[model samples]
Target chain A: MFQTISLFAPQLVLAFFASQLLSTGAFAKRDISIGVRNFSIFVLLIYSVIGFILGKPTGTAFKGALVIDDFSHYMNLIIGLSAAATLALSKSFFQIEKLDRFEFSILVLYCTLGMSIMVSANTLLALYIGIEMQSLALYIMAAFNRDSLRASEAGLKYFVLGALSSGLLLYGASLIYGFTGSIEFTQISEAISYGASPGIIAGMVFLLCGLAFKISAAPFHMWTPDVYEGAPTPVTAFFASVPKFAAMALIARLLVGPFETIVSQWQQVIVIFAILSMFIGAIGALVQVNIKRLMAYSSIANMGFALVALSAGNESGVKGMLIFMSIYVISIIGIFACILQMRIRDGMVENINDLAGLSKSNRSLALVLTVFMFSIMGIPPLLGFFGKFFAFVPAIEAGMVWLVVLALIASVIGAFYYLRLVKIIWGDESSHEFVEAPKTLRTIALMSSLLVFPILILPLISIPTQSLISRAASSLF
Target chain B: MLIAISFYSLAFVSVAAAFMVVASKNPVHSVLYLILTFFSAAGLFILMGAEFLALLIIMVYVGAVAVLFLFVVMMLDVDFVELKQGFLSYLPVGALVAIILLLEMLMVGAAYFAGETKTVVVRDNGVSNLEAFGQVLYTDYAGVFEAAGFVLLVAMIGAIVLTLRKREGVRKQIPSEQIARTKEKGLKMVDIKPGVGIE
Candidate 1:
């Protein structure tokens, strides 16, 4: 019982806040709302700190529905910190947009809770619930600006597609349950370890399709561009950064845990998704004018890179994947912080061309964006290079040279757009007058950008992360 | 043999009613057919020894949901003929999807019948099935039950958030503003105003 409660503490804390916000009208005041938001961030930060400190590996609880381990703890810290930063960054955006409702904070808290649940889930049932919880909050958040037609369209589109994916996931879950005679991951793993069944393969394919949709991988990535383009900017940032970790953690756990035995069956699917996503993300971003859509493609490609690590199917692969995910999310949040600061005549600007001559208008912000762009392009000595290196090295060591080579080519193609953005920022002639970004956004961008250098200098943090990742990887077997 | 006859007829009626729900030309007739479908489905559930499920179907689907559907269908002034105009054009695509679903279901049934998989045997634990279900739901699946509640809560919140709007000129009492009104602001002294009207 204690174990279960501890594992569920983040969600419980969020729920407590949500209930308070709903029941008491006092929290509707702006000051009270800000106070509640800060309290929430503090609570989540404390919870994540406690998770890190008590990183004692608890195998399974609640009859194997929840797993608490180093992987989940690591994820908790990453997700919690990202959420805290997102909330802090939201303040200026909300104030400017005149959307100062307390419900926004409550919804964000719920989204964080959902992500935490997904990271810790061990059963298909728990995993589905977590995914839905997160998706629902996201759908609401996307449509939060109901007065805007674009936001409503984005919300409806996301809701429809998200519902379809949830259906696919449910169908797959039922199929697995039918075949394995149990919904528990351990039982399913045990059942399928001996030999693969066609039914099981089909179920696994469906499940991967659903997971692919969540991660915005190819063939299932139809909704990403539109949703990202249309959703409110801060919500879009949250969508990009927070859910990726949880969903990827889920995929890693599911693939490395229950589905590990039938690697041959699922590995092909993962490879296909990875290659398709890489090429599609690379090719699709080239002609995009919208910065958000471009970032959408960039994220898809990055997920493909991380998926390459997962497809390697080894301890080193899991370690690489974790490092890649953390660094990738950090970079995304930083870049988006810069994007959120883009304004022309007090209205938000999203067109890539609008970034012309950013260096002249605001050199510091431009410099921060440049660092992020280079990191994303996988330049040497940057954190993103190591992220890609770890992701690729494991795959190559596992003898997936073809996949790695193709991924490298795709990265080269993807770099074109990132470089184009950089050129637009620094090289092009000035067009619109740029405004100084909020202090909070600037701080977040600077901190994330600056932290990337530590990975280069220390190189020692990887050692502990590697060991913990391996321990988490071994727990599945 | 009698039980089998009753079960088969119930199943047949349910299936036919379900088809009629879509095939009926009139919207009201369609709703009536839907109610029939639900009734037959509940009867079939009872025949299958799932008494609790049958009661739930009647209570939730027929009692509340179907009635709600009836109200909406009756209240809406939709042109049924115009609505049905596109039915023929949509039929082919819908049929294709239905066929695919049917084939998938058949495949699952075939797999189950092929003896390659084990059928789960739910042992009778000497308690009523309903009692057993409740016990298991409350114990082993309690966490999931709570999560379900959260899902419903989010749905409620989403609905309210999406549809809620403040109307123009709607006087909403702001307690803070009301409470902040001091005696000086709310009242003024009237000293001999009536007697000094000449001035």
Candidate 2:
């Protein structure tokens, strides 16, 4: 019982706070909303610090239904901090838009709780439950503004497709359980390490399909653009960052833990997904008008890059994937923050053309947006460049030079859209000017911009953080 | 032999009723067929000796789900024929999906039989079926059980938030106002001479 508590303390803490906030109807008043937001963020921050300190304890709970280790702890810290930042940035926006419902924060809390569970799950059953819990919250979050028809449509579409993929995932899990007589990752690893059967291979493929859909890789990325475009901008930012990290963490743990021995079979599959996602992301964004939809494609392409690192099937691969995911998430959050502040006269602007003459109006915000675009494009001496470099290095070392070359071409192609947005922001004249962003969003944007710049801060924290990430990565094997 | 015969009969009835559920023109009839299908499925579960699951199906699906479905079907003023107007036009596409699903199911079935497999469930020595189910669910899968509860809670909250509407003109009693009432505030004392021409 003590072991279970230790393993799940973060989720339990968030759950308790979430219920409290919900029961009190915190958002009905201004000060209560702020209080609930600050309290939850503080609690999450402290829990993440404790989780980080716990490190890789090699503790098992409930007969390996849950595991506490370096990888899970590291991901918990990343997810918790991102969630906290997201909530902080959303508070002012909610007040402005009259969307200050207490359910919004409570739902986000539950989603984060679900993500922490997902990262720690050791059994497929637990994993499925975690995923469902997270997706259910997300489905509601996507349609939190139920007054809008588009938001309702987005929610229904996401729920339907998400439920379908979950069904596929559960079916795959049942198949594996039937074949191996175990749902625990360690036991499955033991069984597969000896020899794999065709049934097991199919099961793994189905499972990968499910994870692929969750991460919005190509061929399963149908819902992303619509959902991103239709949901409230803050919810879109939350969707683009926290849940993606959790899903990527799950992919890493499953691939490196149980499916490691059968890399030869799944490697080709990952490579295929990587290649397709890259091409689709590049080609799909060229004609996009909405900035959010464009970012959706860029995210798909970036996930492909991370998958390339995972396909390397080594400790370095895992390390590189973590670095890549972290940078990409930060960049996405910053970009979405800027997008959220694109209000002109009264309504928010979502079209790329509406960004015309942004530099003339708000040069600082324009500069920050430029930095984010450059980082996403992986230009030299920027944070996103390092992310791609770290990921590609491991893949190259694994003799995936061909895949790396193709990914580079895709990066160049994908840069066109980002550059196009930059041109409109800086080079063109606009009829309307951007509204002043809330102080919290401005701070987040500044923080992300500083993190991505890489000149002053890179030397300060890179080596230590890199080594820590590597240590976490090595714990998987 | 008796168990096998009963199981086969139940399975056939369930499959036929399931087919009728989709084939019926009237939405209300479709719901009735769905209830029939659930009953037959529960019978099949009983034949398999999963008495707990059998009862659960009847209670949850037949008792709650089908009744709710019936209510919605009856309450809605939908034009059933109008809803089915596009069915013929979409038949070819639906057929294609059905064919693909059938082929995939066949593949999974083939794979299962081709491999050396063990039955997933083993009969325990001394425990009843309900007790065994309880032990496994509450012990081994306890985390999943709690997560299930979390999912349901989310669903409930979402349903309530989505369908709840605040109207423009409605009188609502403020609980705090009622609770905070004092005699001093509620009552007023008047100092006046009774029926005198003092004024």
Per-model CA lDDT versus the true structure? 0.84, 0.86
In candidate 2 the C-alpha lDDT for residue A146 amounts to 92
**Top candidate, metric TM-score:** 2
TM-score of chain A of each: 0.96, 0.97
In model 2, the number of clashes is 0
Clashing pairs in 1: none
Q: Tell me the TM-score of each prediction against the true structure.
A: 0.88, 0.90
* Model 1 ranges off by over 4 Å: A1-4, A21-31, A55-57, A454-457, B1-44, B61-105, B171-199
Poorest stretch of ten by lDDT in candidate 1 chain B: B190-199
Share of true Cα-Cα contacts across chains kept by each model: 0.31, 0.48
Candidate 1's displacement at residue B20, Å, is 8.2
Q: Please provide, for model 2 over B53-167, each residue's C-alpha lDDT reduced to its tens digit, 9 standing for 90 to 100.
A: 9899999999999999999989999886798789999999999998987787678668778766553677768788988888888887877787788878888778877787769
lDDT of 2 by residue, A128-222 (tens): 88898899999999998898999999999999999889977987887778777789999999988877776677788889889888999998999
